[model samples]
Target: MSFSSLLASSQNHLTPDTNNSLTYTLSELSSLPSTSAQFDVDGAYRLLSTGGFDAGKFEEGIAEMDVGERTAQTQNLETFLEARHSAFINLSLKRSQELSAAMASNLTKASRASSWSAEKKRLQTSLLGSRTYQPPPSSPSHTLVVPSTPGLHASTWSANQSFPPLTPSTSTLSQTTLGATPANKVLWGASRTLDSHAHLHYRHTILNETSTPPDTCPGYLDLLSILETVSPNDLATTSLTWLAEQQRSIFQTFVSQKVTSSSTPITSTDFQEYTTSHNITSWHKVWLALRSSLIPQALTTISTITPPSPVLLTRLKTGSGKIGYGTGDIYRTLIGKLLDFENIQGDSPGISNTEDYIFARLHRLTRGGTVRAKKEDLEGLKEEVLSWGVKYFGNVWSFGLPLFCAGGFEEGISAIKESDEKGNVRAVSLAIVAGRRGLVSREFYEEVVVMYCRSIEGGSPRIAMEYLGEVGRERRKEHVKKLILSTRAYAELAGVVGDDGERVGNEGESTPIDLLFGQGEVRDILRECGDALGREGGGGTDAAELYAMAGEYGRVIEVVNKELAVRVDSFKNGVEDPQRNYWKIAAYNFAEKHLNQGRTHVIERLEREDNLKAGSTFQLLMNLTAFFDKFMEGKFGESWTVLDSLGLLPRTAGEVSNCVDNFFSLDKVARDCMGRVVVAGMECLFNLHASLKQDKSQAAGLTQQGSAGGQSLAQQANIDHDKAMRDIRDRGRLIVTFAGLLHGSLGGEVAKLIARMEAYMM
Candidate 1:
């Protein structure tokens, strides 16, 4: 028989009896469980087929026929039997007549019912009423096995043919495994055809019923420990892979709109139970589900990570010095996350309600609204402002400066050292904040001290002074004290020095300070000092002596006044005390006298001769130049040559000629210096001019004083007015001419002289 025919014939043994006996009859024994059964039956039929009896011939021929048939059928029958048995056993199928026809022509019907009696009895005696059985009690089904194993055949029968298993608990599973097995299970049952939906439900129900609580699930900690053992680089690689998966899953969720509404808390008890017991926390599950392929559900979640505050936004907007990434940067980052949370939660119900509340509070605070309405005051507001300021400042300076600088972004950062912030820009400082979020540069502290000093010395010197004094009292902060003191001195000087020269007294007008609308304190201070200086016989050092030494007339007056009031003894000499003041004042005075006398003598000689002084002008010019030159040469003589020898003075060999052109003009020096003191002089001249312009009656007192010396009207006018005008014009002419000669000389030779002269004045 052919394999198909034999397979069909083998199923003949299956027959449903009354009361579900599930037996088989030989007459219609369409199928068999083994090749032996078919062989035995075929042998019996062959034997019975002999009709006529013959002695030797019949016996020999019969034996020969039997041998030939048995040999021929041996291999074929074995192959056919194996096919039939495997089909019946593996498929649990019934055979058909058409299959028998297709197999072989040797089939014959059995007449006796005793043919399948043994098989029927065996089936009846079995514990199960039917051949099909539930899982575990029966041989396991293996229909889903890859490449089709024997176990799978049994499993399929057991699983499909029997009742489902009892529902199992999933609570004991570890969090880490919650999503693992289910995914495999889904893949397994996807192509099922027999009551596919119900089959799936049944399989799931059995697994669920059999599963232990997540907490009892094993391998969760092992996986985490394995993860921990990974190198950071490997971990990062893993994380990247995991993150990609998460993004995909989130995207899937978004597309499916499953996680969109999210009213069912992500933190549900079921989730907690599964995650904890299975070790399948959100991150793990997310990673597991999406690492291979990106899905919409995961992408949505990935996009949602952000910070919460504008303060945070401000910090992270760029890599400026103002903000950075340490504690403060971290805080800002958290705050930014919070802000993002707020935006996401916009009008949604049951969010934490923090970011919006904080935002509102900040808004009110900026608008001058009191935080604690009833208890608020200036101090409270100040405290709040300071709190925020400190947070911002600390964030920007503490962590930002270094990080931004390290990252090649130093635009906003200031010096991170304890030094000046003179050239610092806002962005650079902000970048510093970004780079080193939580640590301040040493410079930041120094800058604070500097600012404090400026505040003290700016609008209110006394306040500044008091503050500095307080700093001084704290002896440990000597540097701070010195800084403040220095700043105070600078502020005081700046305030006093401004426009003080506007007021003049020589022309009979009040001092400019008097004309000023304000500056009461400054005026009072000056007056006190002046009064003290003028007091007769009262001084530690005379004003003249101090002036001669330092040439700081205002300071001299102030010190003299204080000394007089305090009864300090004055220095015995009228001139400066050489040792105490470094002898610079004496040197300066001597230099000035020589310089003035040289100029006056040269000019007088020229005028008297009714001719130019030839190279005398050059000589006089050299005298002015030589003043500083000679002093420097003598004082710093060991370092440099003398002025005349160095060719810096009038070194012309002839009386008239070459070197004359080389002398610097005095006119330019006078013009430039005029910018500094001309106003003072003009104020005096203006008063004089005003007096001259007034009616003769108004000027009668001054006129009478002039006449008291027996001066005629013409003589009075000529000696006083005319002579004064002449002197003014002469000085003016000399200065203007000098300016004309040296206005734009790029060699800066005149500039060097101007600088030297300016230094000498101070």
Candidate 2:
């Protein structure tokens, strides 16, 4: 018979009988089992193929045929059934073992043990052949299964062979029960529940475990270590939410600790290395935390982690993130810290030491040959350095000279105002230093001139002037000239002149112009002025004044003669020079000063010069000077004669008004000189008034004689007295009106002259 037919016969016999008992008793089978010779195993095999084995039918047939007598065949059949049962059990055990091993390799040890228990329960259920048998509940481990293969049937069973059922131990039952239960029950179970809700407790337990534990619920250090191993993306995927929570908590704790213990030394080497190795995108969080805890240390750490200049510049070009966070944020933060002079308190090493360190680091990071930092960053850095240097180093030039030089001249000059006198001097010195190095622009020198000239009116003009002199010594002549001219122009524009016709408050001190350019250069400048004005056909009176101030009589005379010749030439050409009157006044001042020394040549030359217009204001000034010189020399008569010739002896109100109007028509500078001329003319009028009064008194005394000849003399005296009284009244009114005009045209000095002339008239 074929194995399929035999297996089919065996299957058919496996069914339970109708009476619920064996149809044939073992006694019947025993009747034939005594002798192997009587057993027909081969014939039984043939019969096994013809009809399926019904235990009742087969037993009855065996009894009728005395088949029970063949004990050897029965024994052989029992051996076959036992062998088949053992083979089936072995196959099931092997499959279960394979599944368990596969699961053990793939899952955690706890899961693998649970899977083994589930597999054992499944094997027991299959072996028992009981309808009440139940499979274990599916779990993480139970989800695993053995891959099915052909011809491997789990239900294949033998009736004659029996295996013992599995009875689980108490501990194993509890474990299986726990695995079978719902997740909520398992978590809440008293025996299986966690000891504490704190993460630290759980973390400690995880750290203490010998097996490879999960990194899901790790501590701070554990997370840091994991960061070293995993990529930023993987790390984020694994513990992003947990890391964010931990980051906030840890940062808060760090800040609290730092705030409580301000002297604690904070370091970021580990954090930096971890973030850098993982290329963490949320590094700004870490940096911000560290900075909040300890800014200087955090900045120092970040500065080290900054990429090379090229890479940093490229990243910066990519633009900052929404919150202005980027790879270059560290550099910017460091720069801000370094520049925050007002807030940064120094260590025991002092602010300078800290500044040096910061500056060195900045230079090292930003130095990209010619390019350095980004344009905006470079400009911001320059401004910060200038501000910081000026605040801490006494001046920007002292510590940030290169940066200041790189800036605009207006910026440099504006920086000067932020400093004291000493600081300004130092700044200018540094500017000169830069100039010597050929790093300064033309605007720098120009700005310097402007600054120093501005200071001339300020309270620190002396120091400013001294510094300007030093600068002028090193600078070009044109620059010095600009300085001098700017000082002069500013003084003029600001109306810095006092009542004395000199710069206000500088009488006792050297003028800024004189101090900046020494007297020798001043004389040269005066000569240049003379030449320049002469070329322009304007008088060199300003030059003559400067020369006279230097006590250079020769140069003063030279300038006056050149100026007089120019005026005379202008008159001959009918150019109608307005400044001719001013030049003549300047000449008059010079001549009067030297007149007592018998140096009256200029006065004589001015008077004899006819091209200087016979009735012009120039001739009036010369005549006035001659009149004053004679009056001071006790030549009152000649003074009177000179004054009369110049139409100063006004006989009526019309003449007096005309004279006063003409005097005021001159330039203000010429008006100042003409004030003295008016005073001299008033003196001549006063003397005439006094002489008339004396003659009138004497004529009254003579009229009292009453003799014929005496009467005739008295009559002539009376007529002469009447004429003198009219002249005196007219002259006194002229002097007083002229004095009033002088007071109105000129300032207090002329008013004083008016008072003195009024005293003589009275």
Please list the Cα RMSD from the true structure of every candidate, rounded to 1 decimal place.
37.1, 39.7
Candidate 2 lDDT at 349 equals 18
In terms of TM-score, which candidate is strongest? 2
* lDDT tens per residue, model 2, 402-499: 23312332355446545554334334433433343233565575466446446543443333443444343545344444443434343421123332
Mind giving the per-residue lDDT tens digits that candidate 1 earns over 1-762? 422233244443333232322111221233444343333322322221111111222233444442122211322222332333233322211212223333233222231123233222221121110121111111121111111212111122223343221111111111121222212222111111112233234423533533532121111111121122222222222223322222222222222333223222221222223334555434333222223221211222222222122222223211222333244333233333322222212122211122222222222222212445412432332233233321332333322211221121222233322223322222322222222222234354334434444543434343333222222223313432243234323222223221222222334443322222134433433434334445644433433332322223443323422332221111234332333233333333433543345554323433544533323332333333333333323332321223224332222234123322443333332223322222222223333333343433445555576645564454455546545544434433333334334454423444344343333322
Worst 10 residues of 2 by lDDT: 127-136
TM-score for all predictions?
0.17, 0.27
* Model 1 whole-model lDDT (C-alpha atoms): 0.29
Give the number of the best model, judged by lDDT: 2
The list of candidate 1 runs beyond 4 A from truth reads 1-357, 362-394, 397-451, 454-520, 527-762
Model 2 vs. true fold: TM: 0.27
What lDDT score goes with residue 593 in model 2?
58
